[model samples]
Target: MKIGIEAQRIFRANKHGMDFVVLETIRELQKIDQKNEYYIFVSPGEDKCLEESKNFHIIEINCPTYPLWEQIAFPRIVSKVKLDLLHCTSNTAPLYCKVPLILTLHDIIFLEPKQNDNKSWYQNMGRFYRRIIVPRILPHCKKIITVSYFERNRIQQTLQLPEEQIIAIYNGYSKHFKKIKEPREITSKYIQAKEYLFFLGNTDPKKNTPRTLKAYSLYLKYSDKKLPLLIADLKEDIINDILRKQKIEEIKPYLFYPGYIPNKDLPYLYNGAFAFLYTSLRESFGIPMLEAMACGTPVITSNTSAMPEIAGEGGILITPTSEEEIANIILELEKNSNFYQQQVAYGLQRVQNFSWKNTAQSLLNLYRQTVTS
Candidate 1:
């Protein structure tokens, strides 16, 4: 089978959840499947991470914007390639696809009620675009893949999709995100603090940054250690604004905002962190939670959405709005060595269940089944 994959943003220097999912899956597919020919469709980028192989090819399509790129260039390219199947890795696909289309709708968050306004114009626009495009394209897709069963039910009920047409395939963390020995070597490059709390923050309202900060402030008032917080992907100005709004200006001194941290250096940060905070208001599947767990770090995430299912026995699930619970858990992990070690063991064991190889194998099966049917 000749398969075409729309991985538009994988080549970009800065990648997020969906990009990494496709990138890691493609890399694994390259290793596992030698029988099928594969073509990865992407925009030209500085990263140049994916390479051409005997049966695999990289096709770069240049466009000024995402809409023009997907809605315009993608259809033309798919026609030229005459692909047996085209898997749109991102949420939205070309409205007019020629062949069997399988879409990996990571989540249907766009269809849900809007909460706080987004900080970035691009994010707000992206949300708007998905709200318009996703509904129109779903009927055209032969199969729909979502990241978690929680999202699968939402997609099926919210969109009124047929049960067989959509299925849940869990996302996997990279093998590189493992326990690091002598992690101080890399952690020191980002922050001077030897021990700290790690939280991956962004402008998206669902990230629940303000509440996390509020909880951290409460932790500071009680905890004797007073460990500093290391936040990535958030600017100082934004952090200051959130701190001001939450009325916790004291945490400003305790925070080290590095703006953005590259994926390569994340393992060290996770390894050195006293504990990882992922108390988000919502998530389809929390990849960072698994990444932290793989590093043998205990994760504290919200009980809602797909978090609890993904975290399993490993995570300390607390209500995102409960500052007292989050703060107390942080203090408990620090003061009690036995509990911390037990959580660490559970995390390591739970992490063993997920891998990119498994994700790729399932995806490859879906491609073949769709094409053959």
Candidate 2:
């Protein structure tokens, strides 16, 4: 089978979800399907990441990723590839493609008008594509892949896509996400080695960043222990100031703004943290929670969406919308040592169910089915 994959995001992303999905899946698929010819199509500015192999080649297709380019230029690129099947890792696939197309819809955030909040003209234009165009063209695709069952359900309900047509492939961790010794030489400079709760994600509306800060404030206000809170690269200034005013200072001996910790260092950071706080309002699948679990870090995440499903019997599921609920959960995790240990054990066990190998195989199986039909 000759598979033409839209790999534009993999090279262009600095820190993005779709980039990881495309890069990791293609790497794993290459190992499994040695006989199948694979053509990776990326944008003009984006360089090819994959090496030329027995059945793999990278082809640069000059096109913008957003606005009209996706709807207009992308299909032409797909048509030119002349693939048996084309898989788009992002939601913005060509509305009309000659070849059978499989699209991975990570989350339908744009579909809910409420989630859009107030944004600029171009941002809203992108949302228009996601909300209006994508749903209309969904039934045209051969198959759909979503990161979590929650997302699968969302896509089905929002776009009214068939249940069987959407496959739930849980996201996987990098091999380096397992337990690792704290890099004291590095971590000592940023955090107090192992004496802080960590929250890492974009400070956007859906991530509940303001609420997270409010919850942290409450935790500090009520809880007796003076444990530090470590937040990484939150873009919002107002939230950062709130944390600062609440006396969440930089670890004195080390420089602040740990910037972007590499994948290799994530396990160490997770393992060393007192606990991992995930306060996202809605998540299809919380990959950070999975990484924390893989590192045996006790997690406090939301009670809704795929959180409970991904959290398993492990971790503390809090009502993310409620600051009191977040504080209470944090207080409990910090005070009860035995409960903490139990959560850790449960988290490790929970992570066993998710693997990239399984995800790749399931995706490959769907591809085969799509071609055969």
Each prediction's TM-score against the native? 0.99, 0.89
Q: Each candidate: what lDDT?
A: 0.92, 0.75
Q: Global lDDT for candidate 2?
A: 0.75
| lDDT tens digits by residue: candidate 2, 138-209 | 787888888887888877887766788998888887677777665455557668645677887553457776
TM-score of 1: 0.99
Model 1: residue 23 alpha-carbon error in angstroms = 0.3
Angstrom error of the Cα, residue 259, model 1: value is: 1.1
lDDT (C-alpha) at residue 125 in model 1: 91
lDDT of 1 by residue, 310-345 (tens): 999556999998888999999999999999999999
Local error of candidate 2 at 26, Å?
Answer: 0.9
